[model samples]
Target: MEGRQLQQVLNPQRLKALQEWMQKSSITLTQVNGQRKYGGPPPGWQGPVPGPGCEVFISQIPRDVYEDRLIPLFQSVGIIYEFRLMMNFSGQNRGFAYAKYGDPVTASTAVMTLHHYRLPDGGCLTVRKSTEKRQLRLGDLPTNINQVKLLTLLRMVSDGVEDVMLKMAGPKGREVVALVNYSSHYAASMAKKVLMQAFKKHCGISITVKWTSFSKSKHVSETEQEDGTSTPPGLNPFPKPSISPPHLHPQPFLHNVPAHPPLQSSFSAVGGPAGPPRDEMKPQGPVNCDTVSLLQWMCEVHRLGTPQYEIRYHHASSDGFLCFSYEVLIPCFLIPLYGVIQILPGPSAQATKEEVYRAVAELVIQTICKVSSLRPF
Candidate 1:
């Protein structure tokens, strides 16, 4: 039976017809920040927001498949609260998506019923409970980093930092460890991906980052309270730094702009007379290859003035991923480049803006490298 379904999906003519049918159907699909959402809190939904364990992570979908087929199949188990399929720029599915139900029991039913369910493209879906872990443990931090300062730094470099607690680690308490809480699991996951690199690049610090189990984190908090080492209620931990880093200064040019406007409708800036000598722009020593730094270096080497950016926050998903649309005006380019990025919710608008800036910078650099005949680097 599954083989027959696979045959039907693989038939070019039938697949085309199926796609055409879906296009004409009333199902509303919207693309936002790299994900194709069928229904965010599906239409007519009146239930309370889903809690932990209410979502199932699904994988092994065929790239050609879309929500048209997947949604109805999953609906057999329970009412879907939301469905998001990660999409590629090339108009293909990323072979994985998320299906959220209204309650944990329904979510579990999805896993039990859908796990290893065969798809029409000869793929067996891998369905499981979403971990939804929302805390991270950062180790080997500078011993001098107090909770307040560390919290500030984390907010600057990453999004969705909710709280920070510091503790001594290593022999003789020579090292500091921070247990950071993010507003959502997605935020904690994003921070885990970039915290080490961000710390090294921006703060010149090498630290360890790892996901902490809730039980482990709870134990640590309890221990701190018992030892009377926790920060007192209503008291600030550590004094604010006297001087802020130059690079950490907020970019004044960034502001909310209309999203998805035509290229000609967006702001554009032409390159001014070359600012600095070419050699000064290109680092004499080993270059920092991180996206933002690398793009800045490239702009300098090519004599383009500093890049200008505009970022706008869109709606966040029920799962806690904040979506943003961004545009970067490279002085050398004829038009600004724009795209979407999703990150965990940030503590402030500025933190979210910084994440979008890095994302758009990387996109611009890639575009330049792809189109330039001569190697710019």
Candidate 2:
């Protein structure tokens, strides 16, 4: 089956015929010559062994699949206990992973549903119940990290992290390791991978993050709260408001564009080589080439010596709709234009370019009317 083509392995017509024959013959199609049966044990073998209820084995996973991509795929199936992508010494994926499901029944269901699942990259998955019932590993962190800080970081990475526990290593318990437990195994796996990548890329630190055996002898404690408060033993922490990082966080704006960058780089100034700004054009019900050109030209100019937000018009096209439509793109952020609209006569002998401009502007305004929050790129 490895070297042979699919057609050589099984012909459609013959396989259909064999299926009919088996139904008519009332006999189970157990084995073919030199080959074991599709499932079940061979002759003289004992009954099938039970799989570990919590774990799942996945194979033939695409090499490009990462933590962010993998979590969403399995998370919908059920809460996860662990998701470990096997890596080779060369620091590349080994094309397999073990995901532990919080619910044993859900783990089995995931195997049945996702087995042979087709990926966007054309790779098919092989999902099955794992035989090993091992403890999940802790994500390694830098030394001197406080338990409170560790808990905050893990929570920011994922909402599923349920508890945090720390352990000491080395002489005099000098070295520290934090154990993060998740409500769902999927969250634990995601936190490990995301934190590992974030630390390396943003903080310039290489850290070990993997599954460790769960132990009954270990002492575990609840995470600390925002106000330097600790949760009671065996209880979860209360929700706290999130704080945005100072950098990379942008101020609020109509289009959510980064305002610090010079507007010249993103928007075209009016009357120069760059096109005109949008705000300068007076609300003349209709417009001609001169009016539209003036409107386009007016965008770059500062209104009353004050800088107002500008919208850059690219071009206009019409498709027999009796209306000219235009698309505008802003730098740093993409905004769908929506605002005041002015209805004007359709393109006609008497209608001027200003009328067409107004129609397009109205259309733009209509499209972006509901956008309250702009997402920064």
Scored by lDDT, the top model is 1
lDDT of 1 at 46: 91
Q: Write model 1 residue lDDT over 339-377, tens digit each, in one string.
A: 555565456644544454455555565555444432345
Local distance difference test scores for all models: 0.58, 0.41
Candidate 1 segments whose C-alpha is farther than 4 A from its true place: 1-40, 87-94, 156-159, 170-173, 193-206, 213-377
**Residue 217 of model 1: what lDDT?**
20
| Candidate 1 C-alpha error for residue 231, in Å | 38
lDDT of 2 by residue, 1-377 (tens): 64355444343454465456556745343322211112122223342322224466677766545444454588789655455665544333556666655434456567667878898757998775542411123434567667787677667766566556565544455456655555433445445557777667755776666554311212322211100111111112122222222232222433332222211111111222112344543444334544334333333231111111212111222522222112232211222122222222234422423343444433332222223242111
Question: Going through the candidates in order, what is the number of backbone clashes in each?
Answer: 2, 23
Total colliding residue pairs, candidate 2 = 23
Q: Pick the candidate with the highest TM-score.
A: 1
What TM-score would you give candidate 1 relative to the actual structure? 0.46
